[model samples]
Each structure stands twice: as structure tokens, then as C-alpha cells.
Target: MPDLAQSTFILPQDATLTSEQSALEQRIWAFINDNHNTTSTHLLIISGDAGAGKSVVLDAAFAQLQKAARATSGELAGTDNKLLVNHNEMLKIYKEIAGTKSYFRKKDFMKPTPFINAYRKAGKRADVVLIDEGHLLLTMPDPYNKFRGHNQLADILQLARVVVLVFDFHQLVKLKSFWTPALLKRVTRDYAVTHYHLTEQMRVGDAAVNDWIDHFVRGKMLPLPHPQHFDFQVFSDGQPMYDLIQRRDAETGLSRMVATADYPFTVLGGKTWYVQAGSLRLPWDKINFTDRPWAQRPETLHEVGSIYTIQGFDLNYAGVILGPSLGYDPSKDRLTVDLAQYQDKEAFKKRPDLADTTDAKAAIIMNAINILLKRAKHGLYLYAADPALRQRLLQLAK
Candidate 1:
């Protein structure tokens, strides 16, 4: 049994809150303050699209709440609040950003069953639980969880009085995710539910590029008119694309090559299989979670990244590879997904539960690709393994 109580919470860097974020924070705070002593549970859902500053807002708000708890010795005082997240990389990033400030107890949402069991054994429940990236919450039992549960959200609700979930619907890329808005509403029907929407574009540097990314992800195949400020481009060759990413990384800081999980991955002597496209072969990034994280480590620049590794963070330049799974049909002038060629075994394993039909599987793949496409802050570089898609992108570039 892992010690759930022996964790430290770090506030994210650049903890400044926007006006909209501040308003949402106040609402959540008011709910926590009002319901801390009550026998009733409350649920607050903060909804936003990617780069809408959900994490920043939530981090800042939690810090303030913790401070208030200490100053006035209110209802939150001595309360065992926990910050829950699905990814370890994301937690590490939060710790890096926060430095030394203590926020709350932190735990992975995937291990909820164990945590809940421990709490039940101890005869206690957390007063407040803040779930970051709540969309990644898993419902199915995996190797890590031996306890039975139908939905993670329901289990979490049983463990905390005031549950704060910060999530984006589009970010639910995993097959086992059961945190849909409809499901959330259904599960939290008895609790006091409050919703807040964040709409500002904070990550992407170019608004036009961001709009194009939105339309692209939504299956709108309209040709993108070239933007003046954004450094978006398509490469016919993979070597030059990799070189460009390297140059950008050296100059402007974070730049990475991200691709859909199209190729088969194999670990040979602790090294990931090299991604190959004709003569351009590059080693895929090592699966670094602890010691050296994927985003912060400089050596990761030499390898390719996936949606899982780079989703929550922003990069200066993103070199995107649309693998064989996704293609462009010149005749139809539309993007197409080949479910048969999709190589992400874990994602495909959950296909039966996530999507019953072929079309549904394709849509899921497109969503994954969309996440990779939107990771770039100032620039987007592209290379499609499918020849037709490559040609189509080149045409659009012209």
C-alpha cells in the first residue's frame, strides 16, 4: 500500500489568474467555504478548450484557498485536501513550476481504487479534492487497480465533500475515460453542481493558426489560407523537417517532433525503436517519467514525441507526422482515417468500448492527431507518411 498522505503539492509557476479565472476561483472558493462544514457534497466543473488556461487558473485558485485556510483558520483549516491528476509527467511539471510552496496532498487518479480503500480502512474521507485534467480519469480496472469500480468519477465523489474538476472534453483521448459532461451531470445529480467556462486563447501565439487548428480538429477540411505571423509549414522530406525542429529548438527553446501512434514501438536494450520514413530515421524519445522528464530534458529534442508525452505542455515548434492511419483524399478533398492501419494497441484495445463502428474509431484517431497538432505555441511543422496527405498539405501551403 502506497502512502497517499505522504505527498507534497507544488503550485504551478506563473500563478497569475486572469479576470475570468479569478471569477471562477471565487465561485469555487465560496462553494468550499460554504459547504466545508455541511454534511452535503458539492461538485464544481471548470470547462475549457485546450490552452484556455484551466491548469493555471486551478493552480492559482488552490494556492489562494490554501493560504486562506491558514490565515483565518476557517473551515478549510486542517482539512486534508488532495490534488489528483492522471499523469505523472503533468505532476512533475507542476512541481517544477511551483518550486517549494506546499499546496495539498497529491495523488494519481489512476490509483483511486487503492486510495479510496485506504481511506475507508482509515475511516476518513478527504474534505476537498481538486482533480486536474479530469477528462483523463479512467473508469475501467487495469493492472494498477485490483479493486472494482464502474466509474472513477463516482468513486471520487464518494471520497470527498467538495470536488473540483478542471477538464476539457476534447482532451479525453484515452479509451477508458468516463468523464463526459453527460456522465458527470448524471453522476453528480444529487450534489450541488456549478459550471464555469474558460474561453481565452493563452497558449498558441497566433489566433488565426489556433482557429485553423480548431477547424481542422472538428473535421472541417477547408483549405487554410496562409497566415502572416504563424510559422506553419509542410515538408515533403523528413530530414529537413527534423533539421528545422532542431534549429528552432536551439534558438527559441522548446521544439519537438510529435506524431500519431502509427508505427509499432519496440524497446531494444532500453532504446525505443527508431521512427523511419524512407532514409530519414530518428530514434523515438525514451519513455522518461522520473529523473529526467520528457518535456524538460534537452536530449528529448533528438527524438519523436507522442500525444501522451506532450499533451499538457506547450512547445515553441511542433513537427507533426500524420502517419499511415490518417490520409488526405485528393478526389474528396477531405481527411481520412484508416482504422486498420492505426498502430496504437492500447487505444485500439478499448475500441470495442469506445466505438462500435469503424467510423467511430477513425474519429478517435483524428482526435488524437488533433491534440498533437495543437501543441505548438508559435509554429507548426508537418510531414505526413501518407503520400496523398503530404501532397494535399503541400498544395494547401501554396
Candidate 2:
């Protein structure tokens, strides 16, 4: 977890940011200053793939916002600002960070559903609501998740004068949170809009290696990068990959082994489930109850991580098992996904707009791998379960 903790440390204050650094600052302030009976919410949608510093930007914005809210006198004085994120593990981390700061409070960081429900019930609106990981916001009603609204973002927009969302559509994993640019445009059709795409990658700092991962995620299997500083290993077997991950963890902690959703496991089934590959056997990460995140816990070394556990968190190193749903096409020189082989049925739940098309399903699967592969800040170790994929990847490394 030190790997993640190292990344989450708050950076320089916005007040100290250089003129060249504040790309989103001017627009953020304009919306705050130009508020005069906004019939439609002023929408600031910031998009980036994972590791693009969206969360860090949102955190900096929130810091400045809270300071403004605490100001003695001004147009911005005594204004309310709340930060929201749909992911529970991330929410917990935010709260933990708040615990150390006197000015920050846990109540200020909240899940979207409760924030929306409370505001609607009280007939009030927030001044500025910054949503981190906004892509995880529910697109449809889900009682199990306690989100009964038709759409969470739409609801938040109604409940806030200005909504700043840190989003990445590629991070969409579940059908409940299915989103596309078209859908986003439809949602904000009438809003006064400002948008930004963060291109600077923060976690995976090696650009060449990062590009190689990007190509693979998009189905173009190219030669693995040969960056002298970044470690990229292709394992023909799983056990050796696991061993390397352990060594890396022992050296620097917070390195992990994760897998694609190509194996079967049920939530709350009263039975332990395992992910096995050639002498490498480990249980799926159990439902975490402790305050620590799945990656932070010491016991998780024996458990294989999932997209749910690893997303939005950085690792010192990541040992990834590309499960059976994926194959390498040596002839096509790319990756292929078999939706039928994917075990995460929850991700393929019905979406009215998407219907039964496998395109969305395939993209979701690839996106999961993309997020998994990007979690490592220092290195990435890969093991493909499909023999053809393993061989192809190994050949490319040579």
C-alpha cells in the first residue's frame, strides 16, 4: 500500500501552481465567479485514461475550494464544496487522509448516492461538487448499490450549481455504470460546458513502455518495449511471475499479482475460489473488511487481485495473469477477446442502449486489462494463460 500511499500524497497547493500548470484552473474559477441563477449546471468534464492525474487534479481543486469556503469575506466566502467519488475503497482512502488534516472533514468526502439523496431531501444545492472517478457513477437505477436515481451524474448536476467531474470512459467496467461520449453529450446537451483531457501520465512514467501497453490494450500486439529503467517481464508460467512479484514486494512493498476476469468466482458463496495457472494457485482477493485497501493488506499477497481491487490504485509492481478470455493472433499480430470465455457476468449486465452487442463487452474486458496493466508504477510482469498468447508475447520480448 505504500506504493499507493506514495502516489496519493497531496502535491503543491493550487495557489503555488505555475501559469503553465493550471490548465483546468481558469475555467474552474470562471464557473465559480460567473454563477448568476444557472438554469442548467455549469459542467466541467475532465477526461483521461487511468494514471492521467485526474484524481490528483480533483484533490487540488477541492483543497482550494475548501479554503475558499473557509474564507472570512468575499464573493467565495462561506460557500459549500463537497467531493464525491463512486468507489468505496477510494472513498475510504480519502476519509483516511482527511483524518490527519484539521481543516478537512470526513463528511465533506462522500459517496454520490447519499449526497444526492440528502440534497434532494433537504431541497438544497451544493456550490461546487467535484466528483472523482465519475465514470463509476451509476447510469441506471440499482437498489442493491443504493442508487435509485435514473442516473447519478444527472442527479448530481441538478443538485449542484457547478459539477466538476474527473472521468475516463475506458474505466467503465459494470453495466450499471455504462457510459459513452455520445451518452455524456446527451446528458450535458443543455449545460454550459467546459472540458479537458489530461494527457500527462503520472503512474506509468515510461512513455515507450506505456505506448506498448496502449497498443496491446487496443488489440495491436507489438514488440514489448526495451526501456532500460522500467522492468517488463513476460512469463511463460505463472509461478515464476508470482515469485518475482513477491521479491519486488519484499523489496518495496505494495507490488501485487492480479488477473483478468477469465475465471469463475461468486460473491458471498461461503466457499473460497481459486485462480490457477501451471503450479501457480491463489485465491481471489477476499471481500476486504479491514480499513486497509485490498492492496494495502499484508494477507493479500496470497490472493489474486481483480480490477475491482486494483483500479485507481498504483502498485510498485504488477504481476498480471492474462486469463483465458484473451488470445494472441500471431497472423493478425494482435490480441483477441472471447466474450463467452469471460467470467465476470456482472460486467455484461443488460444496458438498454447497448443491447446484446458483444462490442461493448469486448471493450469492457480490454479496458479491465488496460487498467490492470497500468497499475504498476515501477514495473509490469505479464503471464498469459493462453499458450498462443504467452508464446506470442514472449517472442515479441526477444
Candidate 3:
């Protein structure tokens, strides 16, 4: 599917960004323009909180680069193969670029294709390489030495002349770094970073709503207004939330129903459900149907769409379960969610309770929730068992 079709990639431009964000974007542009003439190794890492316009700026910058490179095609300094890593949108770009129905279904291992092996070998330089949700590129191994994903993009990272990694620190899930403080730390230490903090949020309609999500993602999120169409409501009886979910669910009829780390069912009626992976496999014979197709009876459940899947997707209604993952941490003097276990298999083996750090996971979870909730043409519903959680919801809606 195309990134435009995906809910995550198709960002709505409803609100204007703040002066700070605009300044940051200009600075980044200047840096790129200044280095546009340089032949030295150019790597730019753009980091921001979720909902900040990293992708938005990237879209504009990429378009400019494509225009410039195309204008100076033959006389330019680099190859015509401008490699772009589109995550879920990769297939879309390839289809559009090739302008044909092409599928990688063949089992032949040796013979390489033009589109397939653009960056297959080392010293294979390209005008530029762009990676989205870039944190996924970093995958370190545990003591077991097991690999994460088969596509070891080490070659692509090393080969690209001008490589750009765009991502949010809050969304770092199961990153692999060798003795680094955090994924961002590793990147900043390695490259001549041109930091751009995207503060103005265009996702949530209200400034208060943006602030709520920002705080959930980072510890402290300031209030910033957004454009219209971004609106939300938190319901106590589940009626408001459920009704909204049902409407959207009726439209799609749960065909794209998904499970999350939170619950057994991908979606109940309209609202998406989530549960910790550890809890799903408990002795009660609790099975996880997350990311799987919907089953007939209780044993069959819908699959949880990864953050990448929902990047450009949205739901009519979204229900979030705090479960045992999040709690009030006195040390932080704020809500603390332990999400370290969500992606760490080894850590899960040691401490099972940290499996669902609800607070830490809140922003990403809620961001996913927003992906679903914003799909509503009419309304949105939110439910949290904890009273404080419920109150927080009220604050967001108001």
C-alpha cells in the first residue's frame, strides 16, 4: 500500500507550526543547502516528539532534492538511483516508479534486479537515501545472538552518500545499540547532527489535546493549539466511545480489525483492544490473536497492527486498556510507564510485570489510539480504569 493511503504517513495540514518549529525547519534547510555543494560525507538526523512535523518537513525537503537532482540529471555529481526506504510505503513507491505490476514472489536467490538491488553492494553510491521511522534500522542482539529482522540494512546505511534518518525519541521501541545511552545518543555521537525539534502539532485539533498527547509521550508537554477537525472526547460509561467505535466498525466491518500488545481481540465492536504479550499467554489459556486474522470463536482473535502498519491508517473509535502496565511512580513525580518489556524478550523473561508500562507506552499507544480515534467522522470515545487516567482523558477532551 502507498504511504499516502497509510494513516500514519498521510499527515493532515490543518494547523500552522510555532515560531520555534519554523525556525528549526529553516535552520535544517540552510544546513542542507549549505552542504548541497559539498562532496564530504553528509548525514542528517532529525529527531522530535511524535506528532511533531518531522515527516512534513521531510516531504518538502525530499521534493526539493528530487527536483534539483532531476534538473541537473546528467551534469550532476551522483548516480540517478535516488534510494528511498519508505517502510510500509516502500512497495507503493516501487510500483509507481516502475509503473507496472511487480511482485517479489520469485525464489531465485542469485540473479539481482535493478529495482530490487539498487543498494545491494558496497561503494554503490546514490544521490541520497531516506529512511522513515528510522529507529527500526538499529537492532542489537541479545546474548543469544539471534537476529531481529532478516533485512540487515547495514549495507544501505554505509553506502548512501547523503543518508537521512527521521524519527521520534518517544517512539523508540526495542532499539539495539552497542553500549549507547539511547538510540538518539548513538546517532548524535556518530554524525554531525542538525537537530530539528517539530513542536507545532497538526494532528490533534485542539491545543489542549496536543499537549495531552505530548505529555504522555514525553514527561512534560506544553499546550499548543491545532487546526480544526482534530477533536476528541472521553466517556465514562463507554457509551460515547463505544458508539463512535461501532459506527466506524460498521463501515469497515472489522475487516482490518487489529490486535495490540493490550488485549485478546483486535477490536471489540469498533474500539481496538490491547494487552501485554505476557498476559495473553497466561495459564488461563489466554491466547493472543494479535496480528492474526479474526477467528470464529474465542480462540481466534484479530492481529495487532504494528506502529508502522497504522502509520497512515485511522480508526473510528479507540479503546485503551491501562491494565497493569502503568502506575504512579513517586520517583518521577509523574506517571511512569514501563515499556522496556514490550519489545525486549529477554527482559520479559526476568521481570514480567514491567511488560506493560502503561504510562511510558501511553503516548505511542494513545498515538495509535489517535490514529483510530481520528478516523471518526462524528465522534471519539476513550476509557481508562484508573480514576486519574479517566481525569486525564477529561482534561484532553476539554
- lDDT by candidate, in order shown: 0.72, 0.83, 0.42
Q: Considering TM-score, where higher is better, how would the candidates rank from best to worst?
A: 2, 1, 3
* Reference-based TM-score, model 3: 0.58
| Candidate no. 1 TM-score | 0.89
Off by over 4 Å in 2: 1-4, 7-22, 25-30, 36-39
Q: Which window of 10 residues has the lowest lDDT sum in candidate 2?
A: 12-21
> Residues 1-398, candidate 1, lDDT per residue (tens digit)?
21111111222343456788778778878878887776777888898877777877677667766666556466567776666777767766555444445543333222455666677778887888788888877756665455566677778888888889987777766566634557777888988887888988766777778787787776566555567767888899888998999999889877888788888785447756767654467777666756334755777888888877887777778888878877777677777777888777676555345455454456568778777877777889888898988887788778
Clashes of each: 0, 0, 30
* Number of the top-ranking candidate, with lDDT as the measure: 2
Write candidate 3's Cα lDDT for 1-398 as tens digits.
Answer: 22232233323355443566556546655565555444554667777655555665654555445545556353332333243443433334323433321221112111112222544434355545555556444344333333333222344444545656675544543323211235346534544455445655544445555545546544442322333654355556433444444455556433122322443342225544443322222111123334221211223223433444434334433433333334444355355454542332322233232454443344444444444333222223445544555555455455
On TM-score, the leading prediction is 2
The estimated TM-scores of all candidates read 0.89, 0.93, 0.58
Candidate 1: regions farther than 4 A off: 1-15, 70-72, 95-99, 102-114, 178-180, 266-271, 351-360
Encode model 2's per-residue lDDT on 209-313: one tens digit a residue: 899988898999888887888899898889999999999989988889999999899888778998987689999988776667888888898899998888888
Q: How far is candidate 1 from the true structure (C-alpha RMSD, Å)?
A: 4.6
